[model samples]
Target: MRQTGAVDPTLPPGWPAAVRPPGAPDWEHTAVAWLFDLVPPDYRAHEVLRRYPVLLARFARDHVAAGLEAARAGWRTVRVELADDLPADAMEAAITAYEREGARLASAARGVEAVAGALRGERWVPRL
Candidate 1:
């Protein structure tokens, strides 16, 4: 059976397959679900479930922004540490990774927005 999200289908039995857009990487797609699970059960039951879309959008946007900031900081650190000795290939690889991860994070944020819009009765629905 296919499983969904960061809940680790392999780690737990009966975890539902994470619903996500086609071609989304497993890591990025699963991150949202992992975040959802991080909320306290009581809050999820009472507050999150009722306003999941809005909450999710906020959560995703914050997460992506934080990640981008961290990545930028890390890149700066790498540059400072290596200075003129920096390996061109390694720097290129780091840049590529940062770009890819950024795109993934932006996509996830968009997904959250779409969910929020749907919850607001906006007719948008993510393709399963």
Candidate 2:
């Protein structure tokens, strides 16, 4: 891979700090590492993902989006489904956990998208 200049400080929202902006030195390596962090440890066994970073980005994006969806679904159904078994305070805590997880996954989704774009050779330019 070709090496580029220094990293841009003005990264867009949801851009992961672990990944250098596209074209920076060893940026692809860092991007691959960050993408692997989002996936299951078992995924590390896959040589294809290691060889091809763009595919890893796609997998991370889908995984994060699924997690966000699962969090939303749990948040919607927790009250009705578990109200009988769980105490009110426990239920409240569960809801709060789901909300927090949902927000985190949403941000992860954006981050994965940005990383995927970068892996595909997209560059970020700062505005005036």
Candidate 3:
């Protein structure tokens, strides 16, 4: 077996710790998955990356944008629907939940947008 050198400094902070399951198709591909998962729990981005693969680079920006808008609306709706009788702490917690999810969704959409931009020769790197 070949001795490995240190991890690439340019990659994400914990990229060196990325786990590659046994029987992976390729190291580079698995690394990309690890990179995508870095976005965390925003499985939609990973799903798009996996499903469309090359297509995501060419398409799906609009879909991602729409999804981001929807997430924002959902978060706003939660706040607007809050009851006057609800405890302040409870309302804050509920809104925080929406904010967190909305942020994650927005990030996921941006990840997809980055791929689209990369396709157009933007500085962003395409995950695939």
Candidate 4:
């Protein structure tokens, strides 16, 4: 197993670094810092995540999980009912587009989950 006290080396520079408590490396703050590059300066989500990372984490876990489930269901529908009326290759195109968008949303959700993990105050490292 990887060392819990070690920060994930894969994390880009300036990501919130965490280690064991007594000083758990302030890793939770990294999630907020990480968002700046992904979103606009005035984005309201940034403010909420920055000020209340734990809450943001919980909200993300709850809502994003649901959204992903719904997305999966919709994707299933698209796969099952291939369209004869729509443009040729439309199903493939739609799946590709959905995969791209879903990956982005999943990345954001993972960020909040990472922040929540940090809040737990155990020896911290990113799960590979």
| Highest TM-score model number | 2
| Best-to-worst ranking by lDDT | 2, 4, 1, 3
lDDT of each: 0.52, 0.84, 0.50, 0.55
The sequence of per-residue lDDT tens digits that candidate 1 reaches over residues 15-119 is 224444323455334534544653444544555644454565466557666876777676567666766776889877877787777666555555555444433
Q: Give the better candidate number (3 or 4) by TM-score.
A: 4
Q: What's the C-alpha lDDT at position 27 in model 1?
A: 36
- Name the 10 consecutive residues with the lowest summed lDDT in model 4: 13-22
Q: Give the TM-score of candidate 3.
A: 0.45
Q: Is candidate 2 or candidate 4 better by TM-score?
A: 2
TM-score between candidate 4 and the true structure? 0.54
Q: TM-score rank, highest first?
A: 2, 4, 1, 3
Q: After superposition, how far is residue 85 of candidate 4 from its true place, in Å?
A: 4.3
Quote the positional error of residue 1 for candidate 2 in Å. 22
Q: Give me the displacement of residue 72 in model 3, in angstroms.
A: 1.5
Q: In each prediction, how many residue pairs overlap at the backbone (N, C-alpha, C within less than 3 A)?
A: 6, 0, 0, 0
Task: Give the Cα error of residue 88 in candidate 2, in Å.
Answer: 1.1
Q: List the residue pairs that clash in candidate 4.
A: none
Tens-place lDDT per residue, model 2, 1-128, is: 22333344566567876787676788889889989999889999999999999999988988888889999999999999998999989999999999999988887888898888877877777777
Q: Using Cα atoms with residue i matched to residue i, what is each candidate's TM-score against the true structure?
A: 0.49, 0.87, 0.45, 0.54
